[model samples]
Target: MNYNLKYYKFGLAIMAVILTFLSCKDKVKNKVSNEEAAISTFTNPLKVEFGDPFVLDNGDGTFYMYGTGQVENGFATYSSNDLVNWKFEGRIYEGNIEASWTQKNFWAPEVYKFGAKYFLFFSADDKDNPNDELENFKIGVAVSDSPKGPFKDLTDQPLFDPGYPIIDANVFKDDDGKFYLYYSRVCYKHPVESEISQWAKEEGLYDEIEESWVYGVELAADFKSVIGEPQLLLRPPLEMNDRNAEWESRSVTSGEVNRRWTEGSFTFKHNGTYYMMYSANHYAGPNYAVGYATSNSPLGKYQKADNNPVLQKNIDKGGDVTGTGHNMVLSLNGGKKMYTMYHGRTKAMGENRVVFIDKMNIEEDGTLIVDGPTTESIPKPLEN
Candidate 1:
């Protein structure tokens, strides 16, 4: 039977099986290594000048980010899967003279998925009233079938002008299936004789400065109309409380008199509590910063978080980061982790701003934490 010959053949078969198994294992290991490498190396100032950045996840593993730009006709967007690499999606809304009341000053567009449609809320100057001297900015809504949208205006006018200027519209949907809109009521024509203005004038800080305030209101199901009176959410602190007065007062220090801003409101619910984040000071100045408030309900008698200015420029650390504000928060890894997307200026770039995403955490005491305004590279969000 040639027993030695049979044993030799058996040995060759066993060696072949082991070699095949090793080859498969190497392939799998290399594939995983490549994926990890791709996911970990995201740089800051994400490749685009996205002022007042708003990022929306379509529940389809894709993210679309919108912000202020010089799109003479409409608004634009950028899309990404990994949140690190972005591709421009072009102008998603071009003003229709026949259907739109506004023709210029388009800024800060944010999109949300509602029912079977995606709604885009944005700010622009109303062109309807020629005699109006302010040329006031107002928020309006448009709709599309896809997240990457060429949205059509839902109506021919602004969503319900509060008899004054309003801008930076943000929409939030609560667990009870109700929708709310948060926005900035700009202080353009408001009396400069107010207490804050007087204090500034007396200090020689600068005069004729009015402050922007954050406001919120419930929206009808169609999102085309406001359901109730607007509720004031936040305003710049007139008195310096802790470090808030110093941080939020950067505009005054930077020579932008009467320019305390509390605009760009974004809302998210975590652990049954509602968090509202808003930006302060002039957007173009280095003093721009972000702060938050908390309440039990969406339309809150919300109180400002004592740990105010949760995100701001880190100039004391001595890097090229400044003017950090106008942030949007997104839940990642099935709501286990969160990230804040915002805009900031680098020393090399001056007033020019670029988009950034950084880790956001909630503390045990319900204080919201933003681990950045960082200039260093960071890891991308977990893939769905």
Candidate 2:
């Protein structure tokens, strides 16, 4: 053997092995760096997928999320310490049990803490649809001792029915120790004549259009019944010439659907004014968006804000976000700062609705503003 040639070949083999080791080390470093970047920031269309997203700060430094269609025959919840990182807590409420009045199609679950108990208010299909209504959704209450719960139905039947299909239950307690429940009446089979309907017919789009409206009523102290009849608070405008009519009628005007929605109602009292923020347009369509009205009382002759549709799709502005509606407010910093928690869709994200927490503020004049439906890296929600 030529010993000199053999020694040269051995040297080359050693160098090649060293190069491969360095390459792997660099790759590992890059992977760690990317993970760190993701952990350090938050973004819109948050990782949690659910429609009608609601976030509740449980007073223990943890936030809980509940929404529609997250689980079968019930609602699923996600918990987060910083609102950016989330852990699935599984289905917290299950319906359609033995002798349970709820059968299926559960949607829009809202939880509240009263005294020592946590109450979950949600909508589901009731068993007593004598005529077989297409969406016989009714609001029901479930209770548990803990926020992360095995919540059980408070009654065999729903809390109460207003003789129609309803969904999206929201309960609010005023400072004076009185409680209120707000919900949306389903638009199924309830067509109302409007200028938009006339326009639709005049344009030969559809013969009629259906619309959902928001209603609010006082809740009994025991959380078992309503103190009075629900009063209509908001709905789609009647006149096509109305300023809000254009944006609110996008679902019909765009010819994507023949329905108008004023559902997903969230209300809060600020500086003596009752502000009701609601979603308009079909929930499943890209035209879905948010708007608000102001009234002196929880149940109101509310006036639609001039600057309505405060948060909506940004596709026209070169962003991929759409279907931005069904919002609930998360109050922090002793109610001085508010975050609007809602859901949206993106071109890249496809049809799945994802949670979005965006900074919202009430201007000095009480104009409500929601800062997003953003896809870019944003400051984490916990950050001041």
Candidate 3:
């Protein structure tokens, strides 16, 4: 073959191969883009009637969710590899355990993995308490070797009772290897005669009603007991200037200003700043919403975020979702992204709460944003 002719043939062949590779790369890129577009959004109410939902990733490629209801005997959990679809894992905690202290009102179960063991922190009625039946709700701890657990009580009795009706316990482990417990202290008979209360009384609602406040305390290393006095982390705002007062005062609409609530505390630390996300107002009420406060310390003198009610009802926008509260945040994609898992009410279902998961973002200024209480579909959590 002539030298020039052979070189020309080689050049032609190389060009053909390069063109083919570019064509294939374009096809693959289009396929990925289309797949992402198709998954742009997921509908709200991820599951029917899963209230006070808490999601835990056990590093086993499965996310376990525990919440209120579905088991008369104890608490039930659901599992998902992806945030959208879930599989019922059946009852995790058996209220009928021979030595169980409480047999009823098992609510708001949060699971955490410490070392090789898993801990389930929750609230339930203290059957041994001889006080007014309505004030018997207390916090409890259970343990198991697996994430999907038949968790057994750490003790035969409720965790330390703060001499009040307490519920909605959430535990946080700080960077310093310290553990803290956050819970709601029910205000069954808390009184109010302030300006807000006077306005409520004029509205013809009850002058004195109940409220709930979120409290935090350091935990003993064993995680079975409290290490120090509980610190009042959040309470219903009494004055308008109270950063959270407007959203936290849902009770005032019914003339129960003093009965406002600030509960369901979940804390997350970012960039050395602590953010305590909490729910305010009655869980079943339309005004129930999620808000947060930030501090330099885990056990905080935290201040409410100026843009309060980070997540709440969007009904005014022609959405049917309401009573969105009791949220737990999950870090996904190796902490590249975050999500808020919470419960919301569907218009068709009235006060019955269902679990929903939506994207979350933290601003450069450390402001936490929950991209939800969303009634519209949203993208599922990205996988690793």
Candidate 4:
């Protein structure tokens, strides 16, 4: 073969590849409009109805929000360029379809852009209730090629059930390239002998009380399974005298229900301190609220913040917002600003969960604070 002829053919092939790359880049630019209509401010109960709202800030300057109650037996997504306006993206993951392993009561869908693909971690009941248990909730994973997804489950099974119901899956990737799966074990069948339980029985509200606890485990590289046993990360205090216990047991003490929740956990590291933010109390009730704990490691002996219930219903303080929990932190503009994406209820719209985005920050003393559950119009999330 002539050397000149071979070199000419190689050069032609390289030019074809470059042209294809530029063509695709142009298409990407046209795909997202990037919110030409600027928004200087936004109000609470963002026009989108979502319980347990999770916002994913894709590196390409667009954000996608996913949550519960937006779809039936599955999940839906909303896309946004500015944090103020959102466009419904329709159902991304639907369970209960033929051969689907998960079914009704879908909740808390958190998506992450891992490598070239987006992965969604969510929870729902088992489609096949082989045991016929009352609550058969479990965590499941789905994958998509885009942030606005047609995400399909990776397998026809729940992601490694811990012999009980679990929900509110949050996947975290550490600096070491290891993945960690954090979730809340359901209150179902998890009865414990605690002051709250005894008080519930004494008050004749219920014979026994169940409490949800949060757990964390190292996820396998492929995300197909767990690397080891789940470690108990956080749970409601067994002692009523505990500081956080008071806020956490409002459901039982208020005589609304007979359960305590330590669910809706969102963990992230800020300034070398691993902060795990979690919710407590019944999610559908007024007492549902958020708190945080800090640890030196991803999974460890965590200490709850002195400012317990950092974000709670302002009703007691003469405001309308309630049911503010299941929070996922949104880091925008390359982490220059941070906000909490959670669900809440207004006095006029009781029991109907809606989304709330509020600023959160760390104090000089390292206290994690969520200045949220606000009702009035607030300055929109900082895009820069």
Best by TM-score: 2
Q: Report each candidate's C-alpha RMSD, comma-separated, in the order given.
A: 5.9, 5.5, 6.4, 15.8
Candidate 3 per-residue lDDT, tens place, 1-384, comes to: 599999999999999999999999999999999888767656777864688999899888888999998888688888887878899988888885568888577889999998999999998888776655766788999999998887989988888978788899988888888988899988776564555566676767766656677889999878778987999888776676666667787756744345777888899888888999998887777778888999988878989888888998898788888888899999877678999989988878876788888888998978788877666656667642
TM-score of model 3 (CA atoms): 0.87
Judged by whole-model lDDT over C-alpha atoms, candidate 4 comes out at 0.87
Scored against the true structure, residue 372 in model 4 reaches a CA lDDT of 74
lDDT of 2 by residue, 1-384 (tens): 699999999999999999999999999999999887777777777888899888878888998888987689988889998987889999888888886789999898998888789999999999888998778999999999988888998878888889889999999899899999999998898899998999999998988999998999999887788988999889899998898999999999889888999999999999999999999998898899999999988788899999988999999999999999999998888987889999999887799998898999999998998888878887777776
On the 0 to 100 scale, the lDDT of residue 245 in model 2 is 97
Considering summed lDDT, which 10 consecutive residues are worst modelled in model 4?
Answer: 31-40
In terms of lDDT, the best-performing candidate is 2
What TM-score, to 2 decimals, does candidate 1 have? 0.87
Quickly count the clashes in candidate 2. Answer: 0
Structural similarity to truth (TM-score) of each candidate:
0.87, 0.90, 0.87, 0.88
Colliding pairs, model 2:
none
Error of 2 at 320 (Å): 0.8
Off by over 4 Å in 4: 1-39
